[model samples]
Target: MADKQDKSQTKPTSLQATIAGGFAGLLCIAPLDVVKINMQLQTNRLEGLKWAKRGIVHQTKGIYKEFGARGFWRGNASAQWLYLFYGGSQFFAYDQIKRALAKTDLSSESKHFISGAVAGTFATVTTYPFDILRTRFAAQSKDRVYTSVLDGFQKMAKAEGFRGLYTGLAPSIVSILPQAGLMFVGYEALAPVFKELNLPFGAGDFLAGAVASGAAKTAVFPLDLIRKRLQVQGPARSKLAYGAIPEYKRNMFAAGRAILQNEGPRGLYRGLVIGVLKAAPTASLYFWFNARALEILVQNEIFA
Candidate 1:
């Protein structure tokens, strides 16, 4: 084991490992993502939105009944692209920035937060178009406005200018900056706790990812909801959206105020419950795959 550790320490850490984990996590949680988006976009206080109040099980059944098995994976393609770019860029930047900060006197938490916030901003801005496409694809109903991610991109850009693709970017950055920081902090902190418990191989990584994801997600869920809402705005709102689509017109505060006034604080957290649940396996698989893939790469000296 000592020899193995020394050999592993000598191998280069590959960003590809993080990308692979993101892909795996996306596949595992795609269906839940679809449900979560639908829930987030809905408003129970609005007319014709009473159905939105139904529990997750009912929502899941409704979606399956209407769109069949395919419904649950509406935006999976775009999501795959988003996760690939976001995860790779985020982790790569985080690793680089963290290393640079290691020589500083900043607390570990400060380093993690700064690194994560910067990484999240970089990744979110770079891959944000994919995220918008994913939201539109998932939030739409049977009367699909955008046939596919590429189609959605072309149509949205044509109709609303290229700038339309980045609607909600401000709120996304605001939320994700802290969200990303918290996720790293949670994962770094929780992993050691789980390790101390002497769980099975990779179990610590999995739990750390899950717990970290849940905590961070909860912290920024309202902003996430706002971002999703804004993504589906413009020409498609009247035609293809699922529930009461409030036109915030890029104003996150208006969106928040509207949701608060209309549905109380509960509206802001429309999909929080399901989101947290999904985060469990989603984050677990992501980090586990990351850790395991890094191990394999080191053992094989693949990226060295």
Candidate 2:
């Protein structure tokens, strides 16, 4: 194990590692992504139950049947543009920002939290349009909605004005700040305890990520639900309506209020199950790959 670790500790720059992490993450999480979007796009409780009845296995099979095995990657192209730059910038920003704040005398936890949030916000805003397009394509039926990502952008712009491309900016940015911030803080803060108890850092990261994603996800799931719902808004798929959820289609707060009033608190967490299942691993590998990559960079004095 030690020899393997030593040998593996010479990969690439931190920027490269972050990019690789994003690409690798998209692969690991794509199926879960399909499941997650299907779950999120459920406009009502009954619609959600339809998915529950269908099950992950069946839905996955349906995806394959619809667009073939590659259907699982329906949004891969747009996702690449989003995740690649988002991932690289997020990590790089976190490191640079944290370093900049090193002399500030804030608590270590506070610094970590702030760094992660800033990084997340930076990444999210820059590549946000790709995010909207990715979700739209992911939620699309085999009908091949919007043709391509660029096509989707063009259609959205023509339909809803330029603002069409950024359906969930406000809620996403707000949610990401706390979500990413606390997640990183939790993961970093847990390191010493894990080391004291002799746990592997990677294992600790995976567990911490689960806890972080679960907590953050639950808190902001309504916002996330809003984001997903908003992303798939303007282009009404002529083929599928899921349900007549016209009450909350206009804006975030109204949508949130409608869900809480109609579906109660549980409405916000429509896809909590698959979401966390996807999120935990996503965050875990994000940190694990980053740690390994940074180790290599440091060893090579590239990060020195």
The top-ranked prediction according to TM-score is: 1
Question: What is candidate 1's lDDT per residue for 1-304, written digit by digit as tens?
Answer: 9988797776345454554545553545799989998888887534565445687987888788878999998988999898877777777777778878989999988998898889889889989999999988887778878888889889999998988989999899999999989888888889989989888786998889898989999999999988888888888887655546866757889878887987899889888999889877787787777777767767776655
lDDT of 2 by residue, 98-173 (tens): 8789899899999999998998898888788888888877877656666888897887788878787788788899
Estimate TM-scores for all models.
Answer: 0.93, 0.82
Best model number under lDDT = 1
Root-mean-square deviation per candidate: 2.0, 4.2
Candidate 1: which stretches are off by over 4 Å?
1-3, 14-28
Q: Candidate 1: minimum summed lDDT over ten consecutive residues — where? A: 18-27
Candidate 1 residue 276 Cα shift, in angstroms, is 0.8
